[model samples]
Target: MKWFYDALNILGGISFVSVAVIAYFGKLYFERYKRKQDEKIKSLQSRLDLTNAEMKSKLENINHVSKAQFDKEFSIYHEIWSCIFEVADSVSKLRPVLDHFDPNESREERRERRLQAFYDRYNPLVVAIESNRPFYFEQVYKLVCEYRDLCRKEAFEYQHYEDYPNFKDYWESHEENMKLIKEVMQKCSEAIRDRIYSLTIIK
Candidate 1:
C-alpha cells in the first residue's frame, strides 16, 4: 500500500512538470510567431509606401511634359495669329486703282508703291510661317499658302488695271477678289479659334 502511494506521488509530480514544460515551449512559439507576423506586416507596409511614391512621381512627370507641350503650342499659335493679322491688314490696304491718286504720281510709281507696301507685311508673314512650319497642321499651312497666293494675285493686278475695258469691269473684278479674300480670312479666324478652344479645354 505504501509503495503504491509513493508511485502515485512521483507520477503526479512528473505530470505537473510535463505540463509546465509544454506551456513554456508553447508560449515561446506563440511569441516568435507574433514577432514574425509583425515583421511581415512592416515589410508589406514599406513596399506599399514605395509603390505609392513611384506612382506619384510618374504622374508628376507626365503632367510637367504635358504642360510644357501646351505652352509651346500656344506660343506658336499666337505667333501665327499675329502674322495673319498683320498680313490681312496689309491686304486690306491693297488697291487695283487708287481712290485719290496724286496727279504727279505715274501709274508705274503707284503700282510699285502698292506692291512694296504689301510685300513688306506679306514677306514677314511668310517668313514666320516658314520658320514654324513644323508646328502648323497641314490644313492650316495650305490655307496660309492659298491666302498668300490670292493676295499676290491681287497685288499683281495693280499693273493690269489699264488692260481692263473700263473702270466698271475692273471694279467688279476687284470686288469679287475682295470677297474671296474676306472668306479666306474668316476661315483662318475660325480655324485659329477652334485650335485655341481645343487647347484651353485640354488644359
Candidate 2:
C-alpha cells in the first residue's frame, strides 16, 4: 500500500511538470509572434509617412512653377501697357505744337522742325510696338496699330504746304481724331487692369 501511494504521488508530480513546460514554451512562441506583428506595423507606418512627404513635395514644386509662369506673363503685359502710356504722353505733349503754328519761324522752317520733332517722338513708339508685337494679345496689338495710324495721319495733315487753306475744317478733324484716340486708350487700359484683377483673384 505504501509503494502504491508513492507511485501515484510521483505520477502526479511528473504531470504537473509537463504542463508547466508546455505553458512556458507556448508563451514564448506567442510573444515572438506578437513582436513580429509589431515590426510589420511599424514598417507599414514608415512607408506611409514617406509617401505622404513625397506627395507634398511634388505639390509644392508644381505651385512654384505655376507662380513663376504667372509672374512672367504678367510682367510682359505690364511692359506693353508701359509702352502705350509713354507713347500716349508724347502724343499729348505734341498736340498743341502740332495744331498751332509757331510765329517766330518761316512756314517752311516751322513745317520742317515740327515734322522732325514729331518723327523723333513717333518713331520710337513704332519700334516699341513692333518689338513687343509677339508678347501682346491681338486686341491690344490691333488697338495700338489703330492709334499709331491716327497719329501718323494727324502728323501728315500737319505737314501742309505753306499756303494750305481751311484751318477750321482741319482743326475739327484733328480734334475728332484725338477724341477717338482717347477712347481707344481708355479701353486698352481697362483691359490690362481687368487682366491683372483676374490674376490677383486666382492667386
Candidate 3:
C-alpha cells in the first residue's frame, strides 16, 4: 500500500510541472502578438499625421496666392487712376493758358516743352496698362481703355504741332468730358475699395 501511495505522489508532481511550462509559453506568445499589434498601430498613426500636415500646407499656399492676386490687381487699378487724374489736372491748367500764348517764339517753345513732358509721362503709363491687359477685369479694363483712348485723341488734337483748327469748338465739350471722367473714376474707385474691404474682413 505504501508503494502505491508513493507512485500517486510522483504522478501529481509531474502533472504540476507540465501545467507550469504550458502557462509560461502561452504568456510569452501572447506578449509577442500584442507588441506586433502596437507597432502596426503606431505606424498607421504616423502616416495619418504626415498626410494631415501636407494637406494643411497646400491649403495655406492656395490662400496666399489668392490674396496676392487681389493685391496685384488693386495696385494696377490704382496706378491707372492716378495717372488719369494727374494728366487731367495738367490739361486743365494748360487749357486756361491756351489763349495767352506769347507773341514771341518763347511761349510756343515753352508750350511745346510742356506738351512733350506730358507725352513722356503719359506714354509709360499707357504701356504698363497695355502690358498687363490680360490680368484686368474685363469691364474695368474696357472703361480704362476708353478713358486712355479719349486722352490720346485729345492730346493729338491739342498738341502744338498738330493744333486742331477748331480748338474753340472742342474746348466746351472737353469740359463736359472731363466731368464724366471724374465721375467714372470715383465710382470705380469706390467699388474696388468696397470689394477689398469685404474680402479682407472675411477671415
Candidate 4:
C-alpha cells in the first residue's frame, strides 16, 4: 500500500511538471506573436501616415493649379486629363496592382476600376508642371473630354455611330490621350530634373 501511494505521488509530480513546462512555452510563444503583430501594425501605420502626407501636399498643389487657370476651366481640365493619361501609361507596368483592388466582375466594377486606376496613376503628374504651354486650357479640356468619352465606353454601352461599324474609331480617338500626356510628362520631367540639378550644390 505504501509503495503504491509513492508511485502515484511521483506520477502526479511528473504530470504537474509537464503541465508547467507547456504553460511556460505557451506564454513565450504568445509574447513573441504579440510583439510581431505590434511591429507590423506600427509599420503599416507609418506607411499610411506617409501616404496621407504626400497626398495632402499634392492636394494643396492642385489647389494652386486650379487658381492659376481659374478663367480656363476647360484648358485646366484638358491638362488634367493629359496628366491622367500620362500617369496611366507610366503605371501600365503596375496594372496587376489593381489586383489589390476589388475584383472587377461587372460594368460598374470595370468603370470604377478604370476611373480610379487612371487617377491613381496620374495624380502626381498634375502637380509637376514647370512651364505653361500655349492654349493649354482648351487643349487640356479637349483631352479631358476624350478621357470622359473613353470612360463612357467602360461605364455604359453607347449607341455606335452608324458610319463607323467598329470600336476602332472610338478607341483611336481616345488613344491619343496617352501619347499626348506622355509628351507633356516628359517635358515636365525634364524641367523637374533641371530644377533639381540647379538646386544640387557641389560639395
Best lDDT among the predictions, by candidate number: 1
The lDDT for every candidate, in the order shown, is 0.75, 0.70, 0.66, 0.50
By TM-score, the candidates rank as: 1, 2, 3, 4
Ranking the candidates on lDDT from highest down gives 1, 2, 3, 4
- Residue-wise C-alpha lDDT for candidate 4, range 1-203, written one tens digit per residue: 88866876787865776798899999999999999999999999999999999999765544233333444544443455466556545444222223454453764565455656655654444342323434343334334444444433322332223344576765554355445545554554454333323332222
Evaluate model 1: give its TM-score.
0.60
- Model 2 steric clash pairs: none
Residue-by-residue lDDT tens digits, candidate 1, 1-203 = 88866876787865776798899999999999999999999999999999999998765544223556667767876887787777777766767345777889997897788778888988887887788888655667777777777777777676577788897887787787778877887787787666545443234
**What are the RMSD figures for all models against the true structure?**
14.9, 15.9, 16.5, 19.1
Worst 10 residues of 1 by lDDT: 58-67
lDDT of 1 at 84: 74
Clashes of each: 0, 0, 0, 5
Predicted structure 3: lDDT: 0.66
Clashes of 4: 5
Model 4: CA > 4 A from native = 1-12, 64-69, 72-203
- Cα distance off (Å), candidate 4, residue 9: 4.3
Q: What pairs collide in candidate 4?
A: 75-137, 75-138, 78-140, 78-141, 79-140
Tell me the spans in candidate 3 whose CA falls farther than 4 Å from its real position.
1-65, 97-107, 160-167, 194-203
lDDT of 2 at 78: 72
What tens digits encode model 2's per-residue C-alpha lDDT throughout 1-203? 88866876787865776797899999999999999999999999999999999998765544222566567657766766666676666555444634566578786786677677667767877786778677555666777778778777777666653234776776677688778878887887776665554443234
